[model samples]
Target: MHQIKRRSFLAATGAVLISPRLTAQPAEASQPGSLGASVTIEREPLHALPRTQYGHFLEHLGRCIKGGVWAEGESEDMFLGGIRRELLAEMRAVKPALIRYPGGCFADGYHWRDGIGPRSQRPLRKNLAWSRLGQKLGPEEDNHFGTDEFLRLCEELGAEPQLTANVGSGTAAEAAAWVEYTNGPKDSKWGSERVKNGHPEPYQVKYWFIGNEILGWHELGWQKPVQYVETLKRYAQAMRRVDPGIKLLASGTFGPNPNHAEIHQTLLQGAGDHFDYLSVHLYATEWVAPRNLWRYQILNRQRRPSRGLYYEIMAALSVQQQYLEDCISDLRQFSPAGKPIKLSFDEWNLWYRGYSDLYQSNFNLRDGLWVASALNLHHRYAQELELANISQMVNCLGLIVSTNQGTFPTASALVFRIYTENVGDELLPSQVDGPALPHPTGLPVLDVSATRQGDTLALFLVNRHLDAEVSSRCTCQGLQVGTVAKRVELHHPDAFKYNTYADPRALRISERSETLKVESDGAASRFSVQLPAHSLTCLVLEAKNL
Candidate 1:
């Protein structure tokens, strides 16, 4: 819909705003989609780009917790408390910034208490949301991987824990007590229970969201705006009473809907001063846009195997960004000026091959490109968007898929390695200039974002086009660069070939320092690289101001 509107406006105007960088010379235009692109970067930093933006979401659904993080039964590479040593070791390799846990829709029905006590004694409950409302095709919630184990995992990986409170089937007091149990003194009721559970020290977990998706009908206790705000307010009040220092995120929109504006309006008009952040969840795993997303999420099947599905999925990044843009726009309209709520994309990923066995979907190099490019898109809005968690850290919609046998890093996991290793906290504002692809809308074939820390400048670029390689010319506008220190590219000829434990090289990162050519033009330092189709490139350069 956003794309249609964008294209219609472009068609009506008889011109697409090429942003000065996207337009090419007539001589360069002779080749099919030959885009003479440049990355004109400014010297000054935008702001502190939060590492939390590259956070992860680990749910209680399917093998995401069971076989994904915790070894299902018994394994030699197991950590102290059934946590897989290799899984955590691999996770640490990519550098998980923050981890949201226990639920997606599962949060609504999840009772944190059942999972906290003795693993053997802990009660087995219905896997409500993830298992089709407790019909129980697979095993029920075994309570093997619970609160303390989760925090232990967090401590192991050095990642912050962001727990979602159950508002769907639980009370405000329950939410607050969970906070107290984690962060309160041992003398307190729930905190004493935590001590009894063998943890004497407080975890001091800082991030807590109200619920997963309470606004949607699929949730256990879906509340309308008028009622939902009061529910949020009550939960916030209770939880904050326990730990005033804790940050909170409210359950937010799933996608662009007609109800989007009004819902935000009512949420703010009612609980304007309550939440620290408004949440958002989006995915490009689907091929076509659904008329009814709530139903579509459940239907869980690809409708469009159109010849252009790859491009459509790639182009959906703009739609995802636009969703945030519109959500924030609506938020600003009704939100308090002084205490403005930020954004938290707590649940998001590429998940379309709907479940049969453990919800493991199909993937290829295309998904990897989408993940890297999607991060690039998020980098552009890093100022307003503080945190985003790619859904399912392990199996369900995970970047790292594992089992009792062994584990292998998915193509998407490699994307995190490039960013976590090279991408910095300081955002170096950049623009990608290239040819426009007009299908759903006019969008550039090249996607990019830049950042610098200390002397190293990292350029994260993606050639979203499927066929042709983009010859990209880059320059730092107000600064001079010293040398092309490092160049890494993720590319493969086939989009569908994947890596297993036996053969993990089908999708991998290439360290090609020769691909980057550096030359000085008077005062400006310029570098050029041939970006291949369906590729993610990171150029780490030694940079200095002239």
Candidate 2:
């Protein structure tokens, strides 16, 4: 069980030979100090900051399901049959609050009966784990966009469809008849094959991540956390004997693999009461090669993009927010607080696979300010993030990018459509005395987050200075600001500028509406904005209380 096959092929081909180097540092400019933010509008609330943490992953690998969100032999006009009405209007403009499906490591060699009925009677095979990580559309797959075309693109992006079952070459009765063919009902038995394939309600797919990254031996059921905790309690008791209100996530990891915390303490002492979410899978890569790895990714392939790969992926957002704050303190020291388990950043972004191509991504503006500073640490650890996708949405490392002449939106999907159009509802509490990046835990140069709702608030900034501008300031205590309704910016002076199909508004999303000069001094309300130098902002202020 020494499955360290070159750290599972450099964490499944984001081929890195070690990084934070495409070379070119110093000159990220602004560091002459002084740049603050003190938010703290607390009337009582610290948990839950979810927009499912801005979710969005959909894998069938590269061209993320042939030609980005399916539509192969071309045929658009009112879509849905080929589901690419511009990838459903840029995934209903990044309002996605969960969409993982069919796979990453192709859901343990998927086989929900070769993708449920009609699509000219499916059955073509060969797309085994992205045709062995190369997937040039060859490596066949006529299982045309299967599973009722991925729940009709999550029922046209209202979202929530997580579903990644197929623990390495399937079965607990074929993943419990694919959770009774998507949340069973109509006279059971695979829900009467989803009411004979034409869907009769029940797409009740409330998430299910069972296996993907099965303790990586380049996964395909790469067991070891004590035989994947009894094959995850025989596939969670045969998919809860066909749906016990779904949920489940499991395939977790929190390590540099020294038995990664004894494989998360043997999946929380063997299948921690079945599961509610653990599904980790990060990617802000490294480990380049002690082995060939496809000739060191075709002999060092990384011909562009720098600021040392944008401060080594914005210092891997403070090294994956200290590996998800030590994975929420290893889920409060290994579960059992009456069966709790949340944290499903079900696959993040920024890969290397030696400068991707087959996993297509040219995403920039420093990968949209590293996805708006990784959603300001998922809105400051949004109550242990039950789900947080974004591994793919269209092209492979997507946020919307596809070419043969269409689809755009990647300044990391317009910083996820300006944080899903400013989602707020409490989770506020900010404190920043900025101008950082001198390591040893100092990454800030103004990365922040604050949310509210009634009386609006929703701040969310990220100005990692490439040539200085910050000056910022937002003191606010317990709220009271009164005007400045929206800002939404996704600046670009080219941190490897993106948005192409011959310039899809060459780096768009500018939005405006200003007015915030508040100055109360009765111990709170203060404001002063001006952050732009490799930006990504979002204001919204019009507060209350005080």
Cα lDDT tens digits, model 2, 1-546, are 233333445545333333423332232433543454443455445766767877888777657777677775676463656665766888898888788887877878888788788877788888766565344733478778888878877787788787888888877788878888888888987788888988887888888878887876677758878888888888888888777878788887733343456678778877888888887766665435435455345324542433444565577676677677877787888886687788887777776543254467767787678778887787778777757887877877777876567887778888888888886856777777756754434577777777877778778778885656576767777667775667888887776687788888788888889887788866578778887777877888777877
Off by over 4 Å in 1: 1-35, 133-138, 288-307, 356-358, 515-517
Cα lDDT over the full model 2: 0.72
TM-score to true structure, per model: 0.88, 0.34
Residues 198-306 of candidate 1: C-alpha lDDT, one tens digit per residue: 8899999999989877887667777877888999899999999999999988877776666788888888778878888888776544322222345344333322222
Model 1 global lDDT (CA atoms, 0 to 1): 0.75
Pairs of colliding residues, candidate 2: 14-353, 15-353, 16-288, 17-288
Report lDDT per candidate. Answer: 0.75, 0.72
